[model samples]
Target: MLRIFYHTKYEFVRWWRVAAGLTLAFLAAGLISFAVTGGVNYSIEFTGGTLMQLQFKTPPDVAEVRSALDAAGIQGAEIQQFGANTDYTVRARDEKQVEAQDAGAEGISKQIASALDAKFGAGAVTVVRTEAVGPKVGAELRTGAAMAMLIASFFTLIYLAIRFDWRFGLAAVLSTTHDILITLAFIKIFHIEVSLTVVAAILTLVGYSANDTIIIFDRVRENLKKPHKGETLSHILDRSINETLPRSIMTHATTFSATLALLLLAGEVIRPFAWVMAFGVVMATFSSIYVAGPLLLWIEGRWPRLDDAATARAVRAGEAAAAAPRGADRVSAR
Candidate 1:
């Protein structure tokens, strides 16, 4: 078996300042993005626009499709080839532009489909599907997405508390929240549209972040029982993290590589989701070690009682002693 090497005595907890700095930086960028974009630049799914899927008998040239749409005065349209080179998905013009077009979103979709068919030739292009969401439906979806994220976070906190110590739970929750904020911040910076898929990715990231934290916390608990006489809590935490470093690296690297592949090759329809997932995998890994571990240590500093893994071991030792005496006394009396 190959052994993974790490500095068991290294003081990772002492570098909390580095984690704090990165958090502040992400928050600042997110705030700037908020001001610049006038809140999130939500995708058609949340802002109400037309989505059209078209298929061609032969591969269609993207530049030709763009030219046709431009000639038809459809500005700000987003288009990408999906699945096969011959199949393409086109988003209608931006919400403001689509709303200004007479009639409704369906009218806009028909116009775009007509333009593509004209460019390719009669019957060369087929409209596989067209979807139009209204403003009211989008608003409801936005509200529901927000509520879903909150509910997930709430349940994660509850589960961690029950499974480990309350301090570990609190630290895990905070670290998970940090991952969400950082991912959202990058979404703003990159102009990745906020959609239902992205929301799902964020929810998945919450669980991923929590699971990683729990792993490290569990190891910390196990190590506490056999601490060397002179070892400090900081040393124990560093040791625990080092011991689990190999497993964490393998899990995180595998997920990160898969998400990266999606971001690069999955096309624009899935790009927002992929970008968020890829960004999230990196952030979750960092928080699992830097943010979650340091927070646990910080809590340990403020309230030592919350970090009492040794208490259980001490109780077990006392019970064994009591039982041994009873057995020995009975033997002597007999």
Candidate 2:
């Protein structure tokens, strides 16, 4: 078997300031973008609209299709080529159109179909699929997605607290929360459409980040059990991270490869999900090392455990005893 990053001693915590600064900068930029754009783009599933997939006998001009929709009173509809040049997905989620949908579920879809039929002749185009969501249903789904994320985080905190202690649990939970915020910022900056599938990706990312933190923290706990007379908590953290480096590398590499493949090969419908997962792989690794480790150190400093303080006192006494012998030897030689 190949051994990599084996028995290494790297100071990961020393760069915590740098990592914190970079994270804050990225988040700031995301906030600016969000303000400029007025928020993230939500798909019809969340916004309540008429979605229609159309297939044409021949490829139709996109501009002409938009013109037809506008002529038929379906303003501000989004038209994009889905898979093939001859296939297109139309979304009409404007406030007026959503209100129109309240009158009848398929009303907007019917108008879109008629407009296209008039533009390309009666039999030239076909409606492959149509989905109509009401405002109430969309609102419910949006709320449910939010609740799901909150519940997942709540359970994670409970589990971590039981598994370790409040310090470990709080650090891990905060790190996981950081991952979510960063992922959301990425989505906003890049304008990825918010949908049910994307929500699933964010939830998966939270678990992945939390698990990574748990692994390193568990290692730290194990190391603390053994005697290291002069080692500080920061030193133990660095050692724990170095010990897990090889495993982290392999796991993240494989996951990123899979996500990259999906990003490149998956169709348009899944691209947003793939994008989130791809960014998430790197984000999880980063938070595990930079975010969680430092947070643990800070928490320990703020409220030092009794056992840890006792151990620190013992270390200092040992160092003083060793130095006294050296001082006597030097005085005698002089």
Candidate 3:
């Protein structure tokens, strides 16, 4: 092997520098966005509202249906079509409060039906589906989601520590947090609706972030058993990184490709989620190889031994020490 690794030290070094600079910039932007936007503007799940998904026998008239709801005294109600099909999702404050007449999905659906009936006739329209999630349920969901994310971060940190080292785990967790911040920053900048679906996407991205970090850490651990024990720490890490880089690139590339396809093909309802994943995979890839892996060397004090030979040398030296002490006692006994 013509030393495939460490062949482009300058390139990797510059890459690391740029990555660090970009990370700092990202954090700054997140802070600014947080200050400007006041953090994630959570959807009904956090703000207290009713989510009613509806399906009609025929594609309903958006303007007429909205007008009917407005006439019924509903406020801040949103109606949008979903999928390539003729389904619609309606979200609003408590239907009772909005309409002020003990309005539930039952009542709202009837009004929507009546409105559509006027447009398309009674037999021509049907309320095929209806769901009602109260504001109280939405609040509980928001609390549950936050708790789930915190718990997930905790468990992920623990897993990284147990599997590799505490430092690696901490960095991995931090990197995941970074990914979340960037995702939220995008939401803020774009003014995207931070709905329950978005929360679900955030949690899923957390795991995706951890998975990438774990892969590189696992490689570092394996390299620890090799014989190149006396190599420089940066060079050793560079080699380990190079060895795993292909797999990381391939995995993220495939995911990115799929997410891009979804972003292009899927409805706007799903685009935000797909966009988050697409962006997250790229960040996760870099953090795993650069932040999480390189962090071990920097934090624990690097030596040039992130390879199998380096590990073998250490093991051999330990064994020799153990045997030598015993041999000296035997000689004295003689």
Per-residue lDDT tens digits of candidate 2, residues 1-334? 3285888888888888889999999999899998898988887788999999999999999999999999999999999888899999999988888877778998999999999999999999999999888898899999999999999999999999999878889999999999999999999999899999999999999899999999999988888777756576777788999999999888999999999999999877799999999999999999999999888776655445534455445444553224211111100000
Ranked candidates (lDDT, high to low) = 2, 1, 3
Instruction: Return the top candidate by TM-score.
Output: 2
| Span of ten consecutive residues with least summed lDDT in model 3 | 325-334
Q: Write the per-residue lDDT of candidate 1 for residues 106-128, one digit (tens) a residue.
A: 77777887887788888999898
Estimate every model's Cα lDDT from 0 to 1.
0.76, 0.85, 0.63
Q: Number of clashes in every candidate structure? A: 0, 0, 13
Q: Between which residue pairs do clashes occur in model 2?
A: none
**lDDT winner, 1 or 2:** 2
In TM-score terms, candidate 1 sits at 0.76
| Estimated TM-score for each candidate | 0.76, 0.88, 0.71
Question: What lDDT tens digits, residue by residue, belong to model 3 across residues 1-334?
Answer: 3244333443242255567788788778877877876866666556655455556676666887787677665655788776645677666665454332234535655555565567556676445555444556666787898898899888887887787656556767777877787777777767677776777778888999889877766765566556554444444556666776667667787899998998899866688788777777777776776566445544433222223555545434553124211111100000
- Of the two candidates 1 and 3, the one with more favorable TM-score, higher being better, is 1
